[model samples]
Target: MIFRIVFLCLILLIIELYTFQVLKTLIKSKPALFSIQFISLLFLVYIVYSLMQFDRSVGQTQQMMFTMGLLLIVYVPKLILTLTLMGEDIYRLCVGSVNFFVDYDKSADFLNSRRKFVSQIGLGLAAVPFLSLIYGVTVGKYNYKVIKQRIFFPDLPDAFDGFTITQISDVHSGSFDNPEKINYAIDLVNEQNSDLILFTGDIVNTDAKEMHPWIETFNKIKKHEYGKYSVLGNHDYGEYVTWPTEAAKEDNFQAIKNLYGEIGFNLLLNEHTFIQKGEDKIALVGVENWGHNFKQAGDLSKASGQLKKEDFKILMSHDPSHWEHVVQHDDKHYHLTLSGHTHGMQFGIEIPGYFKWSLAQYVYKQWAGLYENLGRYVYVNRGFGFHAYPGRVGIMPEITVIELKKGVNVA
Candidate 1:
């Protein structure tokens, strides 16, 4: 970890230096250059100072979040500028070499002209992402949006043919810095008034104590006609933060489980429950946190223990990888699986139907939105809250409303 931090710092310094080198021509005076360098240095100081306040052993807090956010806003564009500058240099070398042989007289002019043009273009394009990140921190992070989807399943129980489920995931309460905005999001969830509320996981960033301040606020979410149910995400296991003892860690884990009840959510841990509607019933299975690279505590087999193969099932597994690796091929054939662990990498371009893409997609096959395989379906929520980064970019906080439709499998 220490080596990683040092390596990252070295990389950041390199990018900052290269960016200032390119930016020099854009601001043509020595005094202006000094001013820019001074401001950049101050930003770097603020980032380092904010970071020093938090211990590495403890979970992240709002201060660290803003610090990182500042770095992202400034440095991400610089990183892009660095890459573009390198590409221009490569182009210049190629053209200059060709000119050295073909047109020796105009070689200097051609190389310099091309270099200036590319540098101008690179600096011009850098403003786009820089401004985007600034706006993301200011307004986009709390721009809560509802995404509605309808999934058709041939075997859906008639009683639940049009069952509406409002799903939210990855609350990460510890990272929340604004009460008014969070309260507004909670109210929006209640406004949906779906038949059931399913939370995939990551209620807290690290430990159960993070939820203490927001318990009452979130508990206000109007219970749906059926009920609110949740399953644990990887972060809910209290494994990220350091504990003094194993017993203390266990105590923290137990407290988190209890907190779910305090917030009016039925926390399912490797268990199956039935949502009965007069005569017909649907199976809801929830497992503990399970991920390929993270925790592996979830027991899908045990969670679906007594359910019949024909039962209409909805499994809530925090990580989409779980759905991709296990539930999709399970003999029980879970009709739908809900997840949110990827948080869509908290950044991505997502257009309802035309396009949806994120860096998270590269890591998790079922990262966000919906996926289908052999008739089974998985909907990965983009997450209801932010973490680590403090703000969201193109991928805003999400409240997913999915309506289940009973239909013939025409496909």
Candidate 2:
């Protein structure tokens, strides 16, 4: 882990030095010296911080540094927008509001234009952090904060009638130090009278202790009908933290498993169980963090062992990409799959629909909503507890209240 961190830092330091030298060579003028220096310093700090996160722990611990890094994801677009507008406004102001070339047929000096551009960029850069802070407190709160979005699966089986299932994903509990917010989330889940509670994955950030404070609230969850079930996310298996040795990391994973036991969840690691409602049978299957190109921890064949092909099935898998890539196309006739790894890119809803962009696009197509393929269905929860970013945006946190309707034709 130390070696990884040192290596990353060395690479970043080399790049930073190269960038500084290039900037020094480019800007012989004294006026723009400060801008170049400031940009170089910013790059240097970013590289240093990036290097600090290269721990053996791949989940919450590594990304924990990104609690602030995730802020960059939010502000980059805002910075671009601000810079663009500021440049245009400064251009108009300098050229007179009377529509420059068309009205007066005048061209400004190249140096003056360069100065104005740099000034605008500098102002925009400075304002980015401040604007991001303000926006994070205001609008950015929507990105990671828990907000309810009610959904009713039109064709839930009659055996699961009025089956209010509370769900949360990407908890990233490792990032939080207190239980106040977690308690509130738990209270909200309890208030819903859930027949079943499902947690998709990323339960802990990188350590089991991260969730220790919230164990009280998490254990208070009392949806006893079919009970709470969970699957491991990419974060839960000690993939992103530092330990004395590999055995120590394995112990950390076991600790998190025990934590889940305390929380009253049947943490399924590539397995299935049968839930009987009256005379009808509903099968619940859960797999580990078997995301696209991630660890192949999910084995539906093993989880579905001894189950018939025609049974009503519900799945708890971590990455929704699993649903898009594997579950939807798998030969196994799974009726419904529940997943929550996307966090909806921790961004807001889109203009036409909730289709968000950024890194989320490369993974799952139906990130935080319902999608149907042929006769199979998947519901990807946006998640409850905020992760390293510590807020919820447009997608909103979800606690689905689905009414299982009569058997629909499985055509």
Candidate 3:
């Protein structure tokens, strides 16, 4: 732990020095420069102090979230400045070497003067993420987008062909700060009026109590005709924190499970239920949190129960990695799966059907949106709440409404 701390300090120190160089190059006012440096130093100190205060026993806190936000806001732009200056330094070094060798008779200043325009350009580039991150914390976190998706399946039960399911995942309720905004998002979910609603979980960051205050706001969601169902996400397991005892952790886990029921959802735990439509029915299988890199409590075989491979099924597993690794290859042949653990890393560019990209894609193959393999499908929601950094960027919070069609998609 000490080594990690020292390594971090060294990195921060280097960033600070480079950032100071940029400020020195651009500004001539001594007072203004001193003020900026002083403020930056204070931020750095506060961030270090807040991070040091982190307690594994208690897990994530609002103060920690604030520290993370401040750290990113302060450093990301500075890192950009550092990189820009480093590039210029490389050019300067090359020129200085040539001048020293070729101009031996005359004394020329070792290197060219730092260009003001270069610093200006660097600052300009830095402002994009700086403003974007600020906006994310202040506004983008609650900016919920109801994304509509249509998936086609040849084996889809005819009666449920046009079924619409609204999926909201990774609520991370503990991170919520604005009651009015939460209510607005809830209203938006109801407005979708989909046939069924599925919450592919995270409901809280760690503790179930994190969701206590918002239970009423979430309950405001009108009952769906096809019923509300949910499966647990990794965070719902309360595994991130250190518990005083096994009993305490178990109690917290049980409470988290109850939170779903309080919000009018049928908590499906390694189980399957048939959503009947007249004489036709399709299995709705839900499993506990299972991820390639996380908890593996989910059991697909147990969830399938008596259902056969030929059954029309829709599986809800929290992490897309579960599908990427297991469900897709399972002989049961799940026709469609819904997942949302990635949250698109809560930062990415998505231009509808044209283009979508995030750092998360490198880690999880099915990071966001619909992905298909050999007639099977999985839709990864972009998440309905923020975590860690306290806000989102290009990847806004999402509420997914998916329509299941019987025929193959011609488009």
Identify the leading candidate in terms of TM-score: 3
lDDT of 2 by residue, 31-106 (tens): 6977766764675566457656544445445345453554354344334544554565577576664545446645
TM-score of each: 0.94, 0.73, 0.97
The per-residue C-alpha lDDT of model 1 at residue 405 equals 90
Clashing pairs in 3: none
How many clashes would you count in candidate 3?
A: 0
**Per-residue lDDT of model 1, residues 1-411, tens digit only:** 556666777887888877887877576798988888889889877876676566756778777788888889889888888988878778877887778777675626556443556667878788888888888888888999999998998788888988999999999999887899999999999999899999889989888889999999999998788999999888888887788899988998888888888989999999989999879999999999889888999998889897889988899999888888888988888989998999888888887789988899789988889899989999999999888887788899999999999996465
| 59-145: candidate 3 lDDT, tens digit per residue | 899999999999889899989998999999999988888888876624877788899888898999999889988998998898999
What lDDT does the true structure give each of the candidates? 0.86, 0.66, 0.93
lDDT of 3: 0.93
lDDT of 1 at 154: 79
Kindly report which residue stretches of model 1 are placed more than 4 angstroms away from their true locations once superposed. 49-54, 99-114, 409-411
Tell me, by lDDT, which candidate is best.
3
**TM-score, ranked from best to worst:** 3, 1, 2
